[model samples]
Target: MPDVACPESPVTPPPPDTHTRSLSRTLPISVLLFTVVPLVIAGLLTLTEGAQRLREEQELRARQTASLLAGRVTQLLASAQRLGQAMAVSPAVLAALQPPASADRAMDEPPSRPEVLGDPWLALIRSFPEVDRVELLDAQGRKVYTHPPRMQESPPVRHLTASQPPWYPREDLGSIEIGLRVTHDGADGWVVVGVSAQSLARALEPPAQDGGELWALLRDAQGRVLMLVRRIAGQPPEVQPLPVIEALAAPDARSRPVVARSALDDSAWSVEVQASLDAYRSLVLAELLRFGLTVLVISALSAGLAWHFARSLTRAIREVARAARAILRGHYLNAHVALQRDDELGLLAQSFNHMSRQLEQRERERDVFGRLVSPEVRDQLVQGELMLGGQEVEVTVLFSDIRGFTRLCEGLKPRDVVLTLNEYFTRMTHAVQRFGGYVNNYMGDAMVVVFGAPTPDPHRVERALHAAVAMRRELAAFNQERASYGAAPLEIGIGLASGTALAGQIGSPERCIYTVIGDTVNIAARLEGLAKHESGMQVFMNQATRDLLPPHLREALQPLGELALKGRGTRVPVWGLPEGAELPEPPAHLRRPEEEIL
Candidate 1:
């Protein structure tokens, strides 16, 4: 009947292909969230705070300017008042009141009219630059003396009036007069002090290049613009009339009626202090522009930083992702991430590299373990080995020793001895491995090799014997090469036995070795010792090993009579090929001892 084929098992599908792609996608997003977002938010907050500070600064500047202008106006008004009072108290007017001392005083009385008496007073008033024109009036409503009287004809004055009695109807003086009471011999009479409207207007004028305007207006008790300063001709028509009167009319006015005032004025003779809103606004606007520029610069810098941080974060994430992929692919040596910042991203990269190194170390350990154990045993040991364990098994053991190694070492320098020994061990180890034997351990120039414990071979005995012959042949060539360098020829003795041995790993768990321990191992070592001492040739085999060989192989072996061995009370028979027996020679450099003899 035709064989019925079993159905093949279903192959498991691989994991989703998007795993790495998903990680890459999330990296950029995470960088944006962690790096860029906070930077933008902080930049915006800083801009807002800067703008607020700028606004406050502008407001404070405006208030200070307004206050300074108000103070200037108050000073101007106080100066004007002091000049008026000094004019009112003139010594010239007082002298006019006293009678002439001589007879000529009668004739000079005509020259002594109030006009002559007021000359000095008028001159003094004109001497002051801020004063426009000064005039003195008698109580009869007629001008008695004047300085630049023609100035009174200008349009600024509504009307000029004479001084009158305090109780007289004030309207009769046309309400334009400055009524100051004169006291002579304790009797009071009204004296008029008239300032030219133009002169007063000029006094209120700021310097032509002052870039600001100042004005003063005189008003009656009823609040009229009796005199208006006309520094700039076209004053606002609406402002031509006195606003102080209207302000004073309001009962809620809090400023003292006769004190200096700002734009908030409420007195008949109020002074209005004004500074240009345009100039102030220009300053504020300039500051605002500056503030705006500052904010823009800061925002630009912040954006640049944000971009830099974002890119840095992105790069770090990419590096980490790349490293992780490489590690997953079993590439350990070059797995690393870009270290960009001293922040979390840098720390993450450091951790990823460290983890990769640890994984690499573990993988290296696994490879070393594979080399140490047989494949079957390695699998079980990797699963986890027990320290307190061993197994008894039938196996073939081979022992090799360099004959007269001590004498050779004594004759050579320490370095030369080590070099020769290493070379010999290297050749012997290669031969033993080729024959499927494990080199259990080395004792100076001696080696213990075993077969069929970690990995069992049915023809282990034959393999060990074959390896011993190969080793002899290889060592001969090694020595022939050394002889050219003035070095002695190398001779190695091999001993083989087959028996049950206790085998597994031996020594402390931390530093254990896999080897065999039994009578078979002891016999093999004893045979190798015999080869070094009483040998007819370089290799020896015990009777047990002899029994294991085929008849044709046995013919190749030459028997030596029974010899007493240490640790054993009985004699053991040993055998070897004769020194002159035909055996394949390696190259001239690798000739055996027998080949060298020929």
Candidate 2:
């Protein structure tokens, strides 16, 4: 049978709307969210907590640095005090501090022990570079001698005590000077030392560690910034102000500057330590950036993998859908899906392919089975409705035979005879099936057709008569085609009868066929032989079939009084169609091409 394309099957639902999101797009999104969202949230939380802890640590460090610097300053002052006491009691300074031996001796004259005092004072200055200068004062608290001899003398120390040192500001040098009284061996004098503010600031600065910056400043009792030290990462120590450093920072950069303060004991001075938060800030930012990059990479990989799998899955599904549609359109042979995979989808594909192969095999068997019997019987058998045993049915049987088929075969080769029969049978079968009849048997060039056996039809007799007329017309066209081929034309006679007959599978289990066996079938074959002998008739029918035809078709039948013999107990009445009778137009498929007629 020709394949009929069915756009949509009644049993198959329509596909989803195109606007709906496909698995390919939705899968990646789902996977990205499933994988990346938590990572990003966790990263943000880690960064936040780490930054907080880092700031706290830096602040604590700053406080510790401030306390350390305060203690260091106290130590430095104590050490200086000890050095001054040592120098004050030394013989050279005591001698230098003594009054001039006589009034006559010029007061402007240098002390006799000036070299001794100068040498020790210079050595002290060399040992403690923080000390800029040293001076000697007399018991009257007057400045008398100085190392690296000053051009003019300054006011001497007042209220100097042996137990407590006195500190005085040196405005000219941006420093402070302290006086230590000497009482050893009744030497009443003071040894004064000058301390550089810059040196003090450098001494108080903390060491660099972990990429942080520490800024230290020495403030006096008046709150003046006497000295400032800046220790920044990737740079040398500087003395720039806090405002300048802040201005140089990026606008979006964030840092928590922690300040710690400590007082210098007995000096009315304080040290402030400020720690830069940018060190840990930069580290946190770098970590955040790395985390962000990791998240992006993971999300991208997840999306890519999801897309790949979704594409493979959807592609396989589409292939299966296409194959299923092919099956619905009756193209069983073409219904197949090709997918190479090891996953569940592969298994599905295998199952679908196996199903399609089974369908194709069944279709092939159906076609081969259809060739042996009529398509109607094949359908009945496929539907499991036709029984193995015979059943009585009111069947209208039409029997047709070629008048000179035996003579025609004698004149042709065996191959030619077979081809001729095939062509002739092909047209006849089409005519018979067109009117709801199926060829039950083919006896050489003769065909026995039945209607209303497997399927009941009230118009079975009318349909059988219509089929007889259609066959007569098809034979005329067949003769025309033979004439075109320069072959001899052929003739045929048809006989139809309607009666209760045995109809069903009528053979052994090894090889079975569906056919009818009754007087009606015998009578139809006898009428076909009788038709050829009639002077002007092409078709004959018994009384039972003629009576069943409608009025219009009944009026067209010519009366043929029956004279029957073989297997009949009584004479039977028959009706015939005269040679000159009107042959109705052939079945609608007559207009089809010769190839299609097959």
Candidate 3:
């Protein structure tokens, strides 16, 4: 029979069959997309919406401020024009600008207008501290009767050629002016009030809290830049002049990519809240940056989850694979994977472990049965070819006993006796297995060994005799080892018998043993027992065993005369080891019952 061997390493399982399949293919892509995509998309959308809303809000505030300033300026200019009209019609102006006694004032009747009008116009200019350099001009454009008489020392202004009755008088002192035609008897007189351009600019200055990125340009009706304020990032916003013109003309030209502008109708001026396109672009870019960062964070979290999920899933798969490979190699001992979750993967692992346990148990049972009955018997049974019932087959049986065992036990402790028996049996059992025989059972101090039951053996007798010789030689070496321990040397007797015998599994259903039975078995036992009677011989066989042995082994046997065996119908020819000077003699004190009977 061929030697049976099994493999046992997990570091290398059988290489998996070549295939294109992999975890990437098996794992779902939709799970990754669903887990990550929505968060990124939602962040982008929210950012975009917020940016747009903020832009509109900022633009609205700019327009509102411009409109508010426009209304206030328009009211200021109109009120100043009304003040000029009131001053131009004053009776004090008629007396002060005309000669000390003029004909137009009519040397008649104490003049139609008052000569000293209590200087109410100077009081009006004084009341508005913000107004600087207000002037009262005569029809000739000269400072006439100026308040505090200080204006009379200034150089004369050129005469006005444009003042007329129901007059629209024109005054250009290089300042924003609101003048009413000053009429006495429907004649034109000059009453001009000047508003300082620097003062106007200062009055229109927006609060410093407005961010530095904002620039406000106040352009007059002629599209001249009166004031500009840049409150953020330290650069004045550049704006085209034509947009302001369009603003002044249409009072509705709202152009883009130029400035966030509101035209002031009352002043015929455009309050252009100047900004560059980059401002809105910057907002959009900021939103995009925020979106990119959010995407990175979401992607990282999603990747972590994916990795954890994949690791957990593959761990179970690898465990099952390893256990499966072990089973394939016929090494199913303790082949179970453990998982502690309540998910579906855990259930799958549980089922796999259950299957692994079943296989492991089956492997254990078969291994135990193989050791008990021999591999040959196990193979036959596993193949379903062997019948349970007994069958007669020619077989050779050997029985052995430790010689002088009862005497040896008397000299040693119980533990030493058992140890010696175990060592002796181990050596002898190896001898039988080497010669293709199975040890069926061990009696105290003896072993029953057999050849050719689960397997056929043409050389059964030779093999059995050889095993006996081998065992005796092995025991000699074992005795040498024992001697080193100051232990008494041990010896054994062997007996062989060859004949047809009944061989099969025998006993109750719950417990059974594959063994041989019949006269051949009993005779083998009787031969071993006879060793005690026949001068404590080392080996003995019956005539039947001797006839079957090969010539060499046959020549090695020496005959003893036919003897009556207990429970036998007739005398049987018995055999013993060849006579030689080297053959051992029995110890003197121990002998057989038969010798005493004789």
After superposition on all C-alphas, the RMSD of every candidate to the true structure, in Å, is 34.1, 33.4, 35.6
Error (Å) of candidate 2 at residue 155 is: 99
Give lDDT tens digits, candidate 2, residues 247-313: 4322222442677888888667777887777656667878988999999988887877765666566
lDDT of each: 0.57, 0.72, 0.63
Clashes of 3: 3
Output the better candidate (1/2) by lDDT.
2
Residue 225 C-alpha lDDT in model 3? 61
Clashing pairs in 1: 132-199, 201-229, 477-589, 477-590, 477-591
TM-score of 2: 0.48
Clashing pairs in 2: none
Among all windows of 10 consecutive residues in model 2, the one with the lowest summed lDDT is: 1-10
lDDT of 1 by residue, 408-452 (tens): 778568998878777887788777766667777778888888877
Best by lDDT: 2
| Candidate achieving the largest TM-score | 2
Model 3, CA-based lDDT: 0.63
lDDT of 2 at 287: 95
